[model samples]
Target: MFQRRKVIGVMGSGTQAHRERVIPLARWIAEHGYDLLTGAGNGVMRTAAEAFVAVAGRTGISIGIVPGQATARGYRPRPGYPNPAIELPVFTHLPLSGKQGQELASRNHLNVLSAQALVILPGGEGTRAEAALAARYRRPAILFGAAREFRSFPEAFERLATLEEVCDWLLGVMR
Candidate 1:
């Protein structure tokens, strides 16, 4: 069968509140059979994966993009580098630093472009960078949670305060 599930990229902070919000959103996406793509780190990434796994009869996949994977030693493996919820992990091994290097940029670029749409959760520069890339690539992005605080979104971005609104927008638009 030649079937490609539209991937939904999730960007966000690792805060407790952020994770709390992502839980429901991730479950909805999984229940609806939409694949997911995330940075594959801890905090929000783990929360999303956990939420996806919590659902039954979920056919969607969880893909994690691990940056700075140049080599096993390129970057230290954190406790939850590849969260258990991830069914597949793309180790980019980008030459740039995993945190903030050219490699991270490459990862963010790929994450933003690969997905049909993105649901951005409030985070730091990495999350913000993903939003900027979405603008540069003209990708549809729905900003959720504290990310809405980041006013001045680019032309392609829309700020959604709730998970339901973000999910609805993604399903309605990304089909």
Candidate 2:
């Protein structure tokens, strides 16, 4: 019987790539055969997808939750979405993000709910909202980055300073 691969969501800034931190984590996730899930815009999302797809011979693929909006011309993908690295784009009509990420209409809801686990990186309001949704939904998650970066974030998610610790947590959660 075929089994579905677990998806590991990486949430972070849509403007800052955070490459030094996201690249290795994405590679490790791909190397381990877990599908990578992201917001599919830019910054951490694009960086993570790029790294994940660059892994040679990896079975896992990059999945992006693309946000769109309804207009007089019908729904259209928001600007800068699907950032070239996404191999599997799951587009949605929910455009609200940032401060409204937790709202029902936000695509952040889909990003949080679709993944089996999550790794949160340095980000802004939208990332914070994703972190909140992760906690609210009880998904296994870890804040991976410097503590200072998430000073204003929720205290519920355990924060890890290194990728090694994050990997360990992922192994435990996945098992």
Candidate 3:
């Protein structure tokens, strides 16, 4: 599917994202007119969604790729789970995943494939895994706020110290 709007995937820690950097980056993504795609679980995703919704005159969509069935296993869309700002919530019908990771692998695939680029922030194993997925998918991605240790498939990812550099690169590439 060819999206008319540029979709940028922001990958980072779901539990412990850097508030100062992530929040501003979220707002910037909205302000710059780029659609955002995320796992939409919590933490970084929620922070970005909230910031995007706060900005006025944003010409972007906040889409969440949720994992789980719509009804099976008592799955239901909640207001606060994916944050209240997501305009398009996609239910993957996989499973709520992190460690026991089959569903996570699927969710990760969708997350990487849906976007034109990925912005990686500070994170743990899961974040690392997402980076790897981006590499495998040959998706343009960058790692911010940390060292570039993950083995990129093509080994061409950029490592930036500040969020501004990351944002600049993403905007340039996507635009």
Candidate 4:
């Protein structure tokens, strides 16, 4: 019997790592034998991937969806992609992100669609856009952050204040 390993996507700020929350969450995902998926950039993405990779004897690898655009030379990853922690990098030609993250040109679509479940951290517009896509796609997703960070987000996402709640929600959804 063959079974594919599940992938857990973690979305958040490209500038703020939120290490206090992301490190433990990422390690938990790795320890549980689930692949870690992210935007493949800095901040939360990098932090999560780094933490996931650091876990000893973990079965899952860090998977990063890198955003880029076609140039005269060829396609190139956008600045700060893959962040050294990604064991597998899925490069894309879609360059749009941030305010335009919901657009077709953004790799956020793939990030939201590919994962079995998602964990959202405190982030900016780009993270919000990913959250929107998760809701639109009807994926099992939970926001792991303070209420103020996601006040304007869709009501479908349950905001969790503690890591324990986030882990419980992840276990429920991933199951």
For residues 40-112, write the lDDT of model 3, one tens digit per residue. Answer: 8677887777787788999998999876656656776544556577789887666544553324535777887
**Ranking of models by lDDT:** 4, 2, 3, 1
Q: Write the per-residue lDDT of candidate 1 for residues 1-175, one digit (tens) a residue.
A: 8977779888876544366678899998898888989878776777888888789998889998876544455554434567788888877645332345223446777778788888887776667677777887788888786543776445466677877788789879766
User: Which residue pairs come into collision in candidate 4?
Assistant: none
| Candidate 2 pairs with clashing backbones | none
Candidate 2, overall lDDT?
A: 0.92
Candidate 2 stretches with Cα past 4 Å from truth are none
Model 3 lDDT on a 0 to 1 scale = 0.75
Go through the candidates in order and give each one's C-alpha lDDT: 0.74, 0.92, 0.75, 0.93
Score residue 35 of candidate 2 by CA lDDT: 97
Poorly placed runs, candidate 1 (over 4 Å)? 15-17, 71-79, 95-105, 146-148, 152-156
Q: Which window of ten consecutive residues has the lowest lDDT sum in model 4?
A: 145-154
TM-score of each: 0.84, 0.97, 0.83, 0.97
Which of the two, 1 or 3, has more TM-score?
Answer: 1
